[model samples]
Each structure stands twice: as C-alpha cells, then as structure tokens.
Target: MPKAFPDRASTGWHSHRRAQLLFSLTGAMAVDTTDRRWLIPPRRALWVPPGLPHSVTMRGRVDMRTLYVEPGSGVDLPSSCVALEITPLAQELIIRATEAPLLYEEHSIDGLVMRLLLAEVARLPTLPLWLPLPRRAALAQLCEALLTAPDIGAAAAPLAQSLGISERSFARWFISETGLTFGQWKQRACVLAALDRLSAGAAVARVALDLGYDSPSAFTAMFRKTLGISPRELGRAKPRTPIVAHG
Candidate 1:
C-alpha cells in the first residue's frame, strides 16, 4: 500500500493480522511499540511482526509504502521488530508491488515480483536505529524523557542518582536488561534522535547544538561513527541501480 501522510500525522496504536514492512520514500517516521521505538528515515524500513501492537508518527510529509504478508506465507521473516536497510533493488521492488493489483495470478509477473520482494526483505541487514526501553517504571519514564529531548551529555552518575540507586548497581542492571552500557544506550538514543532531525532537513549545526553536542563537528563525528555516513552525505546519497526481476 502506498499512502501519503501530512507532517505529524499519526496512526493510533494498532496491530495487523499480517506482518508489515513499513517504508518511507520521503521524510521520516517513528514507530513505537510497547518496549521499543524505531526511527526510520529514507532508504530504511521497519519490519513489524504480525500481532505486535504498534503506532507510527510521521516526522514530516511522508510518502509511505507498506507491504503486508500473511502468516505462514513461506517467507522466513524476522520474529521480532527490526529496522532494515533497504537496498535499491528492494526499494524498486516495493514500489512495483504497490502498483500491481492486490490479487494476481500465482505464476504471473506480479507474483514473481512479490516473491523477489520477500526474499530481498528477508535478507536485508538490520540497522541499529531503535532504542530499547527499560521495563522498570522509573527507568522507562526517564528513557521517555530522553527520547523527547535527547541529551548527548547525559551521564550514568546523574541518572543513577535520579533513580535512587548506586551508580554501580544501575550500571550493572542497565547492561543486564538492555545489553548495552548506560553510556552506549545514551549515545544510541542521541543518534536515533539526530537521524529524525536530520531527515526532516534540520541543519547539522542546529541539530548538534539542540542535542547538546559541543559543536557540529563533534556531532558529525558521532553520527558518522554510528551510521558510517556523515549528516550531509546522507542527503546526497545516491540510489544504487535497481535489479531486474523477471517472471
């Protein structure tokens, strides 16, 4: 399905009987589930497992494309939510599928396209664009606040103090629950927030300062290290040649 959403438009919490591949051709979106939030920008997609309750909010005017696959459809899909990096071939396949009739002959060109799309999606590499939420109420609340207003300078000591726990205990618990140190988690949060802002055409300097980075260079360094691409280069990224899918 191909649809357009105006800036800030949201789909209230919902779930589908079929698994979903949510891709945006333009703009960005945030997908929120009970225990995680994914920031999906252009050239990336979110794989939502069937029956997982979730919601999506557009960061700007988004040209959204989605594919719904029935359960036990013979495709080895991911068992959990993931953010996948969309290759050019997968991108083209998705667009083509969206244009085809919803019901098509089993051996027809449309069917072939659908099959290839599923294969491509299944093999697509996942990206680290999601933030894991702690199950503990207080920690979850703190994470929610950070997502709303990320601070790159956030330190474990202060956070531990706020949670009324010793720094060592907080650190150990955080690693046990999230599989990431407090510093690592905080940096990931800031990077995801930066992607949302950068995708919306926010200037690098502005985003850097807003995220509490000392300077744009420092922010760009972190962004590049996390994603392997600088902020400016993301906008200039060129699409790879599409692979031809034959019947």
Candidate 2:
C-alpha cells in the first residue's frame, strides 16, 4: 500500500497479523518498539515481524509504501524488527508490487515480480540504524534520555555517576547487557540521531555541532565508518519515486 503522511504524523502503537516491510520513497520515519528504536531514512525499510507492537512517526512528509506478507507465507524473515538497506532493484520491485493487483495470477508477470521482490527482501542487508535499550530500568531510562537528546561527547564517568555505580563496574555491566562497550553504544546513538537530522535536510556541519561533535569532518568520519556513506552523499541521494508498473 502507498500512503502519504504529513510531517510529524504518527501511526500510534499498532501491530499487524502479517509481517510488514515499511519503506518511504521520500522523507524519513522513526519506528519504536518496546526495546528498540529504528530510524528509517530514504532508501531504507523496516521489517516488522508479525504481532510486534510498534509505532511509526514521520520525520517529514513521507511517501510511505508498505508490503504485507501473510504469517505462513513460508518466506524466511527476521524474527525481530530491523532496518534494511533497499537496493535500487528492490526499490523498483517494491513500487511495482504495491501497484500490482492484489490477487494476481500465480504464473503471471505480477506473480514473478512478487516472487523477485520477496527474494530481494529476504536478502537485503540490515542497517545499523537502531538502538537497543538495556533491560535494567535505571539503565534503560538513561539510554532513553540520551536518545531523546543525543550528545556525542557524553561520557561514561558522568553517566555511571548518575547511575550511582563506579565507572569500571558500569563499563563491565554495560557490555554484558547491551553487547556493546559504552563508547560503542554512544556512537551508535549519535549515528542514529545524525541520520534523523540529516534526512530532515539539516546541514551536516550544523547537525555535527548540534550533536556535540568538534567538527563536521570528525562527525563525517564516524558516520562513514558506521554507515559506509558520507552525510553529504546521503543527502544528495534523495529518493525518487519509481515509475508505476503496468500490467
């Protein structure tokens, strides 16, 4: 299905009986579940497994496209929510599938498109555009605060002090709980925040400074290392609507 959401519009907590691949041809969205939050920028999609309660908030005017797969479709999909990098081929196929008849013949062209699209979805590379929340209540609250107002310069000493734990103990517990070192987790949080801002047309330097980076170059280096693409390149690669497929 193809739908347009005005800037800041939200689809309050909901779940589907079938799995869904949520993509946007333009703008960006944030998908929040119980334990993680995913930022879906242009050219990326979020795979929501069946029965996973989630909410999507538009970062801008989003031209959203969604594909629903029945629960027993026999396709191998992730059990949890993930952000997938959509290749050009998959982008075109998704657009076509959204336009195809709902009940196209099994051996027809629409069927072939659907089959190819499913294959692409099953193999699409997952992006590191999500932040996993810690299970502990106090730690989770701290993480949530950082996500709400991410600061690249946030330090473990201050965070640990706020949690009433020694820095060394906090470091050990953090890695054991989240599977990432404190610095690593902080960087991921900053990257997700930068993506959200960049997709909304924020200038790279402005976003860098706003996120507490010393310089745009410093921020770009981290962004490229984590996401494999520079901020400017991503901004320039704005998504375009694919031509509708004719039966």
Candidate 3:
C-alpha cells in the first residue's frame, strides 16, 4: 500500500523477514543500519536485505512505496544494503507492483512481471549515497557529533586532542576504522549532512554557510559532483525561505 509520512517520522528500528525495495515517490528519507546510513532522495531507492535490522526516518512528507520479496525468491540482489538508481521502467514497475494483488498467480503474466521487477531493480546502478560508519564506539561518537556540527570540519589536531590522542594516532585510528583519511571523511560528512538539510527544504545558501562553504555556488558544485544533480533539481524540492540580513 502507498503511504505518506510526515516530516521526521521514524520507523524506530524494525526489520522484515523478506527483502525490501523502498522507494520514495516524493520527498526523501534516511535508512540507518549498523554499518552505514543511506540518504534516499526521490531520485534514488534503497535495497534492504532480509533480516537486516534497520530504521527509517522521513525528511519531508514522503510518499513511500515498498515491496517485500520473499526470501529465496531467486533474485540475486545485493546481500547488503545498497543505494540504487531507479530507472524509469523500474519506477513504473514499483508503482504497479504496489497495486497488484497481495498474492499473484504463480508463473502467470502477473508473476512474470513481479519477477522482472526484481531483475530490473538488480540491474540498476548503485550510488554513493551511503555513509560508512565507524566501527569503534569512540569514532562512532565523533562521527555523530560531526553530522550535527560539520562546521567544525577537518581540524584533526583538535579532534585528536578531544579524544585524548595525538594527531598521528588519530590519523591511524581513523584510517584503520573507516579506511578513509580525515580529509575524505570530512568531505563525505559535509555532503551527507548537507543532503539531510537540503532534502528537508532548508535554503541552499543557508545550508552552505552552515557547513562552512565560502559560497552557495561552491556548495552546489560539491553536491553536483558527488550526487550528479544540482541542489535545485532534487525532485519535489522546496527551498526554505532565506534568512534576512537585517541588522
């Protein structure tokens, strides 16, 4: 069934025995798992493997369509959570699937269509819309802090100090934990955090400034480079009103 969730509504840690294809026909949402977090804008979808514990949160009034595929259905989907590029055919099939009878006749046209749906979804390209989380609790804590306070940006010395470690030690730990250098992690964090705010209708300029960009255009460049879409073109986007410059 189609569903609508208000902004910031949460599923609060749930899982299904069957794998799921979660698509937002409008607005955006986030899917969080132990290993990573996915920002699923209307332009993308998330494939969640069966039995993988996850939580969902809405970024706006999300028009959500989901499908539950029985395990052992012979669809060789990714064994882990993945962000996917939803092609036009896949989009149509997803919408159609939601409207089909809960139980379709096996091996008939209806059944064949549902099977093709899985094939099409598996063929779609994967996107870098996921944020790899650190495994260590200390590093994880710091990552959470960065998400809310990305303006604090890549100052490794102070971060290391806060963790009671030397800069060199901090670098080693970061690399060991996430396989990303401090600079790489910072940029990813900035982009992810920006996506969260942007999808929620926050003004692009304000989000840019909040994330320490010198200009909104610069932030736009980074966003386009990383996600291949300008901040303005994200589907159903409604910019939050710009804050006034009144003295």
- The per-candidate count of clashes, in order, stands at 0, 0, 0
Clash-forming residue pairs, model 3: none
Candidate 2, pairs of clashing residues? none
lDDT of each: 0.89, 0.89, 0.83
Candidate No. with top TM-score = 1
**Residue ranges of candidate 2 with Cα displaced over 4 Å:** 238-247
Error of 3 at 220 (Å): 2.1
lDDT of 3 by residue, 1-247 (tens): 5888998899999899999989987778888997888788875789999899999999989999998988888877888888898876777778778888888798776787798899998789988887778988898899888876886246899999999999999999989988888888888878777777877778999999999989999889988988787888775433333323455
Model 1, C-alpha of 70: deviation from truth (Å)? 1.6
Cα deviation at 210, candidate 1, in Å, is: 1.8
Error of 1 at 132 (Å): 0.5
What is the TM-score (0 to 1) of candidate 2? 0.91
User: RMSD of model 1, in Å?
Assistant: 2.4
Predicted candidate 2 versus true structure: per-residue lDDT over 58-126, tens digit per residue: 998999999998876666777778889888889889888999878889799998898888888889899
TM-scores for every predicted model = 0.93, 0.91, 0.89
Rank by TM-score, highest first.
Answer: 1, 2, 3
Worst 10 residues of 2 by lDDT: 236-245
